[model samples]
Structures are given as structure tokens and as C-alpha cells.
Target: MAETLDILVIGGGINGTGIARDAAGRGLKVLLCEKADLAAATSSASSKLIHGGLRYLEYYEFGLVRKALIERETLLAAAPHIIKPMRFVLPHHRGLRPALLLRLGLFLYDHLGGRKVLPASKGLNLNRHPAGTPLKDEFTRGFEYSDCWVDDARLVVLNALDARERGAEILTRTTCAGARRNGGIWDVELQQADGSRKTYKTRALVNAAGPWVADVLNQVSPHSAKNKRMRLIKGSHIIVDKLFDGDHAYIFQNADGRIIFAIPYQDHFTLIGTTDVAYQGDLDTVSASDEETRYICAAASDYFKRAVVPADVRGTYSGVRPLYDDGSEDAASVTRDYVLNLDTADGAAPLLSVFGGKITTYRKLAEHVMSELQPLLGFSLKPWTARMALPGGDIPNADFDGFCGEMSTRYAWLPQPLLMRLLQAYGTRVDRLLGKAADTADLGEDFGGGLYEAELTYLKDTEWATCAEDVLWRRSKLGLHLPAAAHKKVADWFAKATEIAA
Candidate 1:
């Protein structure tokens, strides 16, 4: 007989992990299975900002904007090690929407979220303000607002970790090949990485497969009769050298009714993105085209004195936004808000399918999802996740600065730069990774950039990391810094190590 679970969540992305974590914490037995590595899909491919998406206001996404803004501090508090506050500068253009309109939007973004932790929006005279130093002189005015930056992949892992700690089982590299509702129980068949198959029976099934939601309904649970559609829009990003000196990011108002983000990333590079184009290609093969590269570079060059062109880009990635198709003709105008379709067909087990969601709103989406499942769980669910901390996030009121100072003092033998890197990546858990190491040699071999053997081992051993790409690309952006030869060496080493271990 297959093992029975209270809930079975497919897809190891943020929403799946978040829902699994929340359900498990509420005393429900949960099993989460991912077709690939956690966050190997669209979760890690995000623009990596936890912003409220000020541009969405133009589409009147007030509810989404407010929920996302409120979740910013909440997420920071939940996972301080991987998330933090960031400021964005929006330069004023005379031909574009008036400054008054921009200011009003900022005003609404500030007040809508009941924001107490992040600072409010401030108007800036771009000619003299420090944020304007990098911008062209023609942009005489601008505005700055607060948002949060997150390691999207790590957030999913952390949520999965918390879920596991709360008695949830996370199955990475496992695919849900089949699911059927049978007599108030979901009979699920899974295909694991090593060619092993297992069946599971669960009271409920959650289809959190971001881009593959339709595929799941049609293939995984074919019996379901829910009418839902996913609008596939391709959003691409390019990582280039940091063009500005300040910590602030720049939000450019594009002429085609799209807003592009040039965010500070990795302390050495800038992350620029995202063109919304209607895509109908294979989800796994989404790549940033040459045209997309030129488009993004043009957007970046519009506000900066330094020119951005095709050659300046060092890395590129693309993700398919499985936006809930609301019949919007413009690809950029499609709503990012999510929807939960609960299915309890005739007299069978329930299937909860998740539609569209953003990196900023996954937590609340999870909360709402599970709340809808409260009646099925047969309990008066008390909300328990609001103020709780996720793993290493318990760093003294989420004070990242104070935590860094303490870490430096404790690891005085370590170089300041290396220690800072550790604190940024692992936060309070750096000590656990350090164990009894006393010097730089204890960190193991150096593989160029900020990557060390010790950290790589920690990631592989703990975070379900199985490949060099998972380490360099998704886990960290060091892939861009490592030369071709060094990159090949690391990739070769990882493959050899995995083989030997197997």
C-alpha cells in the first residue's frame, strides 16, 4: 500500500515550497515533489527583485501591489539571510507621464501596503541628488522608493527547509507523472531521478507548477474538468558589469509602455531585464535572443551616461511567466496576480491548482491557498506564519548590519571580504558551515571569484545542489566572474565528485 499524506504538492518552486511549509507547520503531513532541482525552473530565473512592481500600478493592479509591498518586510523578517531592503530610483522624462503622476503612484505605493518598516518614497532633484549622479543631465528630476531584494532560489530552499523541519518531506528531482482522484484520496505516481517510481495517496493535491500548470492539468490530473488557461509571456534578463557606484537600482520608463529594472547585483554586477514578449516555445529552452539583448541595453543606456550595448552583457537568462490569461491584448499588460482553482469533482479528492504569481507574493498566496483548504483539513486553523522566522532569519530583529559585525568579531581570523560573503550567503548559519575551521586554508580550494570549496560543499551537501550550474548560476552569480577555463574546471570537478559519490 502506498503511503498516505494529508497534502501532496507538485513543483518545488517558491509557491509549492511556501504552501508545503505552511501546511506542514499547521500539523498537516505534507509531501512536496519537484521535477527538477528546487528553483531550477522559473523561480531562479526571476529578475530577483521582491519589489511591489510600481509599473503594475499603471495597469491598476492595486491589490497585487499592496499585497506584495506588505509582504516585503514580512519576507525580510522571515529570511533575513537571503532577503534585504533595496532602494530604486525612477528618473523623470519630460515626454513621459508627468512627474505629478509618478509622484502620485509612488504615494499610493507607499500608503497602500501599511508599510511601516521600509522608508517611504522621496522625491529627488536628479541634477543634484546622489541618485542622479549616474543618470544623464537631461533628467533633472526623479524619485526613489524602497523594495526588497531576494535570492529567489534560496527563498524556496529556505521555505522547504522550514517545511522539512516542521515534518514535511521534500522530494527534489522527482516528477509527478500521474495523479488521479480516487474516493476522497489523490492517488499520485512519481518518477524519481534514479528511475524509481512510487505511488502516493493524499487527501489533497496542489498543482503549483508555475509554467507547467496546464500540462499538469492535462497530463498529471487529466480527470479534472477545470477550465483554466496560462498566458505564456517570455521575460528575459542580462547580467552586465555594474554601471553605477551607488547601492540604489534604476527603474526606466520604456517608450513601449514597459518598465525595465537595472538592479545592483552580486556587489560586482548589475542585473538588467525584462522584455515581455508573447512566447510559444518550449518552456525549458527559453533563451535571451540578440534582439532582447539590444532592447534591454537600450533601456539601460537611456538613463546612464555609460553606454550599454550587446558586448557589455556577460550573462543572459529567460523565464516564461505563466500569467493567468485575463484576455489582455498587450503581452506586457497581463496581470501578475494569482488564482487558486479548487476542484472537488463529483465525489473525489480535491485538486488545488495555482495560476499566476510573482516572487514578491508567493507567501501570501500560500497562506490564502492553505486557508482555503482549512475546511478540508478539519480544523479551526490558527494563523501561525505571520511573524514567524524562517531558519537563519532569526538574526536579532533582522538586523543584517549588526549581524555582520558580530560575525566578523567571531571569525577574526577570516578575511573581512570572505567573512562578509559568508554572512551575506549563510547569515547566522555561517558558524555551522565553519565548524572548527581556523584559517583561509580551512575554506578548501579557491575556484576564482568568491566561491570556495567549503561553501560549495555546504551547498551541495545541504541544499540539494547537484550540479555546477546550480551552484554558480542559481545559487550564486560567480559563473560570470570565473574565466572559461576556471569555469570548465569547476564543472568537471562537480561531475567527477557526483559520480564518485554515487
Candidate 2:
């Protein structure tokens, strides 16, 4: 006899992990499975801004904007270290939107979600502002607004961590092979990466498989509802050597009426993106097209004094956004808001399918999922995520700077740069990761680029990091800093470690 689970979530992206965290916290028997690494797809590939979708206001998406705005502050307070407040400089192109229209949008953005801790938007004289130094001379006027920059991958991992801590079984590299309803319970078969399979029964099933939402319904669970459709939009971004000196990011309005962003990434690089093109290709091997690379470079080159060419691109990434098809003529015009569909035909087990969600609204989406499942699952816990801090996010007053100061004093022996990176990555958990290590010598073998054996062990033992790619790219962007030799060394270390574990 298989044990029955209160909820079984398929997908390990932000939404799936978030829903798992919420359901597990509510005392429900929860299990979440992912086919690949966490945030290996659309969730990791984002503009990386927690904003109100300011441009969506043009299409009259006031509700979506307001919802995201509210979540923006909630997420900031919940994870001060990984999520930080950022100011955006939107340079006004003479031929594009008028000054009054920009001002009106910014005003609504400021007050829409009941603007609190973050500063309000204001007009900028690019001629005098430091952000203007890198911009073309023609762009003299602009608007400055507040949003937040997030480590998108880390956010997903933290949510999963919380869910695990609260008693959720999180399975990575495991695919929900198939599912069927029997006696009002879902019998699910999961296939692991090592060719092993496990079966479980779940009272309710959630198809939060992100890009594969439709596939999960049609192929994985053939009897499930198949009325919904997903619009796959490929958004691509490019990384280049730091284009400007300021911490601020730039929002360039393109001639096609689309917008692009160039944000300061990892201290030494400028992250520019993203193109919205209708995609109908291989989802597993999505990559930036040559055309998208040129498009992004051209878009950024339009505003910056320095020309950004495809030759200047150091790296590129692309992901397909699985959006709910709203029959929009333009790919960029498709809704960023999520749609939750609950199907309970003939009193059978419930199937909740989540479609088209942005990273910023994932938490709220999870809350709504729990709300929908409450009567069916019989859980009485109220919504508690908004007030409670995520894992290491319990810094007093949510003061990241103050927390860093305290950490500096406690771990004074660690290098300033290494300590800051760890503080940013793990927050309060840095103490746990560092443990009783007193100095760099105690940290063990140096893998170069500040990646020590101690941190690798912590990621493997605690964070479920199995491969070097997980440690280098997703867990942290140390791959960008480390040399190729160091990468091979990291890979060798993982191979040996996995062998030892097996």
C-alpha cells in the first residue's frame, strides 16, 4: 500500500517550490519533484527584476501591476540579502513616449501598490546625473523609479529549503513520468535520473511544471484537463563587460515600442536583455539566437554612448516563458499574470494547473493555490508567508547593511570580498556555513575565485548541489569569475564526492 500525500507538486521552479513551501508549512503532507536542476529553465533566465511590470500599464494591466508591486515589498522584506532595492534610469528618447506620459506612469507605479519602504519615482536630468555619463548626449531627460534586483535562482532554492525544513520531500532530477486517478486519489509514477522509479498516491495534484504544463496534462497525465493553452515566448539576454560605473540600471525604450534593460551584474559585467519572440522549438535546448543577440546589442547601443556589438557579448542565455495564451497579436503583449485552474469533475481528485506566472508574484500565487485547496485538503492555517522571513531573511528590521556589519565583526578573519559574497548568498546562514572555521586555512582547499572546500561541502550536504555546474552557475555565479582550470577542478571534486557517496 502506497502512502497518500496531501499534495504533490510537479516542478521545482519558483512557483512549484513556493507552493510546496506554503503547503508544507500548513502541516500538509507535501512532495515536490523536478525533472532537472532547480531553476534550470525560465525561472533562472529572467530580467531579474522584481517590479510592477511598468510597461504592462500601457496595455491597461493595472491589477497585475498592483499585485506585483505589493509582492515587491513583501519579497524585499522577506529576503533582504538576496533581494535588494534598485533604481532604474529610463532614458527618454525624443522620438518615443512623451515626457508627460512617462511621468504619469511613474506616478501610478509609485502609488499603485501603496508605496512604502522603497523611495518614490522622480524625474532625472541625465545631463547632470551620474547615470547619464554613459548615455548618448541626446538623452538629456529621463525618469528614475524604484524596483528590486533579485538572485532569481537563489530565491527558488531558499523556498525549497524552507519547504524541506518544514517536512516536504523535494526530489530533483526526478520526472513525474505519469499519473492517473483511482478511487479519488492520484497514483503518480516518478522516474529518477538513475533509471529508478517510485510510486506514490496524492490526494491532489498540481501541474506547476512551468514550460511543460501542457505536456504534463496531455502526456504525463493524459486524463487531466487539456483545455488550456500555453504561449511559448523566448526571452534572451546578453552579458558584456561592465558598460558603466554606477550601480543603477538602464531601461531603454526601443523603436519597436519594446523596452530593454542593462543592469549591473556581478560587479564586473553588464547584463542586458531581453527579446520577446514567439517560439516553437526544442524547449530543452533553448539558446539565444544570433538575431536576438544582435537585437539586444543594437537596443543597448541605441542609448549608451559606447556601441554594444555582438562581438562584445561575453555570454548569452535564453528561456521560453510558458505564458497563458490570451490571443494577443504581439508576443510581448501576452499577459505576465498567472492563471490558476482547478478542475474537479465528477468529484474526482482535484487538479490545479498554474500557467503564466512571473517570479515576483510566485509567493502570492502559492498562497492562492493553498487557498483553493483548503476546503479540499482541510487545512486551517492562515496565510503566514508574508509576515514570516524566509530562511536567512530574519535580519532585524530587514536591515541588510546592519546585518553585514554584524557578520563582518563575527567573521573578521575572512576576506572582505569573500565574506560579503557569502553574506549575500546565505545571509544569516553564513554563520552556519562557516561554522567554527576561524580562517582561510580552516576553510580547506581553495578552488580559486573564493570558492573553498567548506562552501562546496555545505552546498553538497545541505543545498543538494550535485554537479560543478550547480555550484558554479546556479548555486552561485562563480563560473563567471573562475578560470576554466578551476571549473575542471570543481567538476573533478564533484565526481569524486559523488563516487564516494555512492
Candidate 3:
């Protein structure tokens, strides 16, 4: 027997989970399925910023910039625990765009999106600023602007969690093998990772498959009107040891007219990225090439006083962006705005295919997706996610620092670093993961770096985490801090745990 749902969403990236959460909250019976772990693709491989896309202003993408800028605070209010304010220092280069032009772009970035909460942009004399210590001496002037940094992977997981809590079924490691419109419902065949299969019925079908959107459409309805119209652009990033001491980040302009970001990451590494190249390879096999590595290092070394090389890189990741093929030749020139392609010809059930979106505006994109399908799906509920809090995001008045201070007092026995990490990752839910634990040993066997059996259990039971990679890389970035032997130990634990569960 197949359960009929109001909406069946394919893909578990930010957009998919966001739409699932929105629809579920609107009193719709929604089910979201992901081929792998949530955010195991483009959502997790982002620059990790919630900004107005300041560089987009040069291309006159005023509307996209404004929408993202407005979402900056909207997301901050919703997930204060994982999203925080970040300042960026953009040094002036005589060879690139003029300082006046830069100032004009910043001006638009400052006011385009209601301009509240975050500080306004200002000119800086790099020689007198603390951020200048690591920059080259030739760079004497710069501009400073405001943006927000996010735990990209955790953001996706939190959305899935919220959707699940709101009566949505979140099925991870499950792929939609095929789908078709039957009368007034969609019959979707799903294949699990372990080779099991299930059939589901839904009134509306949503293809929020980030990089695999086009492929999913073809599978659902081969020879459909919406087929083969996605531009696959690969963006690669490298993580190196901290380059500068300040909490602030730097945006450097390359001679080729593109910009790269050097931001402080995970408190111990500097995140540098991303090379824009036309990628026509398999999305599952994408990795950072040696050329992209050297390009990032060379680009950062040009502006910073400290020269960076390949040896400085500690980690690298790559993701392919499925931008709408607007006949654009250059990869970077494509618009980041999202376009919804709804196909309901011949009075059939609707199939909405999402194309082209960034992480910052995923919430707004989800809302728009629901608005488009409300009439077709026969739902009259109003939007409610704007004022709702994501799971564990209801910190006291959205003040993460103050909440941390109070938590430290409550759990004084825990190490300061461990406590801070837990607070940052789980927020108010830390209490749930650490129930009745008074000391380190009470949490269970230690896996090093404050990772214990208890937290792993919570992730497995609640967050749909199945393996060590899901815990180390996505749910958190603790893999970067853990020892090489610890990785094997964690993997062994999951392997044994799976056997026990089976």
C-alpha cells in the first residue's frame, strides 16, 4: 500500500528541504527524499556566506542583490546559532575597477535591501587598519562591508529537521527512480541506498534536485517540455591555515576581472575559493584539480603580504552549480537568480522544476515555489516560515553569545571549547544531546575532540546521520580537527552500529 501525500519533493539540498519545510508548515502533507545525505552537494560546497552578492552589482543584478541582502537578516533571525555577522575588507586595486565604481557598488549593496540590522559600508585606509597587517604594502586603501557566514551543511540539516517536526517525511539516501502523472496524482517510484524500493503517490511533484534537476525531469517524463536546459558551472574551494588574525574576511580582485574570498573558517583555517570553470563531467566525480588549487593559492598570494602555495592547503571541495542556461558564454556571467519551470500542459498534475538559486535566498525561493503551486495543488494556506524558528534556533531573543554565557554556567563541567562547539552546532538542543550528563565520562565513550557516543546517537536517531562522513563533514566540520586514526575509529563504530541495528 502506498501513502498518498499532498506534495512529494525530490532532492534534499537547501532548496528542497526549505520547500519541504515551507509546505509542511502550510498544513500540506509533504515528503522529501534525497539521493544521499542532505546538503551532500552544492549546498554544502558554498563559499559559506549569506551576503548580497556585492560583485553581482557590477553586472547590474540589482534585483538579485537586493533579494539576497534582505535574506541576510531574515536568515540570521531564523538561525542565529549557525549564522553570524561577518565583515569583509575589499582592497582597492588600480588595475581593476575604479574606487569610485567600487564605492558605488557598496552604496547600492548597503541600501538596496532595506538596510537594517547590519552596519553600512565604509572606506578604509588599510595602512591604519588591523586587517592591513597581512595585506601587501601596495594596497593602501580598501572598502569594508557587512555579510553573514553560515554553517552551510548544518543549515540544510536544520531545515530537514524542521520539516520533519512539522509533519513532513524526510527520507535520506533515497532516490526517485521514476515519476509520472496518473489522473490527479503523481506516482513516484523511489529506490533506497540499500537497493530497496518503495512507491509513493502525491498530488504535486517538485524537482528541487540541485545539480541533478534536469536528469530528474527526464526520468519523470522523458520528452517533456522541460528538458536539457541547465548550465553546469563548477566552483572549487580550498581550505588553508588561518591567513590573518582578525575575525574579518578579505575579498581580492584577480587581474582577470573575477573576485576571490579569503575568509576565516572553523577558527583554525582560512577558506579560499572559488574558480569558475565550465564543467561537463559527472557531478558525483567532481573534485578540485591541481590547476584550481594553484590558481586559488596564487590569487590569494597576490594580495596578502604572506605568500600562499599549494602546501598551505589543508582541504579542498568542489560543487557544480546548475544555473539556468540563458545562452550565457561565461560561467561567472550567468545570473544566480532562480527560475521555476512549471509544466502542467493538457490539464495534468503539476511538476515544478527548480533551476538556478544561491544559498542566501533559499527561503525566499521556497516561499515563491509554494506560491506558484498553491492554486494548482488546491492549497489555500498562507506562508508562515518567515516568522518561524528553525530547529534549535530559538535562542534567547536570538542572542547566541548571551545564550552561550548562560549555557556555560549550566554545564560548567564541560570543557570551554567543547561547550562552545556544542552550543554553536546544536544551540538549545545541546541539552537534549547531553541529557543527564554531569561530566565527560557521563556522555559516553569519547571519540576525541569532544565527539562522544551520545552526540553520534542523537545525530543518527534525529538528524538522519548514518555514517561517519555525515557526522564529521556535514552535520559538523569536526573531521578537520580529529586525528587520522579517529576517522577509522568512527567509521568502525558506525559499521558495528549498523550491524546491531539490523
lDDT score for residue 165 of model 1: 91
How do all models score by TM-score? 0.96, 0.99, 0.99
- For model 1, how does the per-residue alpha-carbon lDDT over 1-502 read when each residue is reduced to its tens digit? 6568999999999999999999998889899999988898889889888888898899999989999988888888888888888898999888888999999999999999999899999988987888888888899889999998888888888888899999999999999979877799888999998999989999999999888888999985675554356788889999998888888888899888788999988888899999999888888788999999999999888888988999988889898888888899999999999988988776568789998899899889988998888887675667778889887788998898998888878899988877886777777788777888998788888887767788878888878888888787777767777788877877887898888998
Question: For residues 106-217, could you state the per-residue lDDT of candidate 3 as single tens digits?
Answer: 9888999997789999999989999889999999999999999999999999999999989999999998988878988899999998999888999899999998998998
lDDT at residue 31 of model 1 (Cα atoms) = 96
Q: Candidate 2: global Cα-lDDT? A: 0.93
Q: Cα deviation in Å at residue 383, candidate 1?
A: 2.4
The lDDT values for all models are 0.86, 0.93, 0.92
Model 1 residue 44 lDDT score: 88
Instruction: Give the lDDT ranking, best first.
Output: 2, 3, 1
Off by over 4 Å in 3: none
**Candidate number that wins on lDDT, 1 or 3:** 3
- In candidate 2, position 139 carries an lDDT of 95
